[model samples]
Target: MSKSSFQGTTRRGFLAGTAALIGAPAFATQPLPVQEVEVSQGYDPLRPPPVPEPPVRHNISSFQAKHWQPYFSNLHNGAILVDTQSRALHFWSEDYESHMLFPSSVPLSDEMTRRGRTSVVRKVKGPSWSPTPSMKKRNPEWPDYIPPGPDNPLGTHALYLGWKYYRIHGTHDTRKIGRRSSNGCIGLYNEHIAKLFERAKVGTQVLLI
Candidate 1:
């Protein structure tokens, strides 16, 4: 199959076929904390500003695979494992015995989702969107800046990876969670990304394979 076709098929297939994969329980042992913040304007040359939504409960377990048998022993505790082939992201517990694996969407093909070992360089809440140079070249109609809001592609939270311009972030559209739709960044459900943001700290090791 052609690379683009393979990517499109792989993303859909992984989401449909891997629902039973072992991981963390759908429900968390403890209640998630709540925080409130102000929204700010992002880059937008012509569009009106967007309206931000209040924080909501993150029922991540309902959409994630249960914690199952350990897989990568070489990885240290608190590491993140991105199985691009499986279209899933696994966050290891501090002991490395348990993990929470969330269904994910990757770049449409290998060229976009480059293999690498990196770390969480930074964390941004209500991150704004600025079209990358490549993005602008592909679609000149894209706005110069997008404010943080429901319409923002970055969703509620973003975990910036070590690679420049690459991130593990939330999506405004939940429907895209399991589809190969991004340029190269990892995409997760808004609630799932919020949950991950709370647990993932700067410098956390990330292995993308």
Candidate 2:
């Protein structure tokens, strides 16, 4: 996409605001539209769950670097490599000579993105989210469940990895994509995850480094 494609007033403002909010608290005080729940924790049950700021759609494509890498051809077709140090993911494409690589930002977190080799085990569309046991222990106020939708933390699609509680999934908060923000799962832009969902299959190897 060209730089001019993102020059509209609303788009520019959103982009600027997103850049400013990096490193800010992920949660906002605004109340979510969902029903309320009571809790023992200090959190106000009435407060809305933190939703990510509206995504600057072209920000990833505009700011993250992507390029062809013939070296990726050495990997099996459809193999994925997550380079946490670079905050990028690489997939070896079937075509070796022409377009042999696909790259996208895959943000890492100190707590998440464990270094290991795993494979895609399953895939889901509009995946639902339930806070893991550790997450609930940290914040007892979290909802028992969040159905699939805009408010859901896992966006449009999910590719379950072999590891428990870890997956390659889309994020409700696009701002978190290129940052160290997840618990253990790899996150991608909603659109990028959707495209990846269509291409990746069960048993596809995934390497994190």
Q: How many clashes in each candidate?
A: 7, 1
* C-alpha local distance difference test of each model: 0.63, 0.57
Pairs clashing within candidate 2: 32-48
Choose the strongest candidate by TM-score. 1
Cα lDDT tens digits for candidate 2, 1-209: 32122221222443354345453322222321222111111221312322433433323322322232422334453667776765556554443321112223343345545887888999999999988898888778889898888777777899999989888887656556544656677777676677677767887778887
> What's model 2's lDDT at 136?
87
lDDT over C-alpha atoms for residue 207 of model 1:
79
| Residues 90-160 of candidate 1: C-alpha lDDT, one tens digit per residue | 78655544445566767866778878788899999999998899889888998888889877888899999
Q: Which sections of candidate 2 miss by over 4 Å? A: 1-77, 94-109
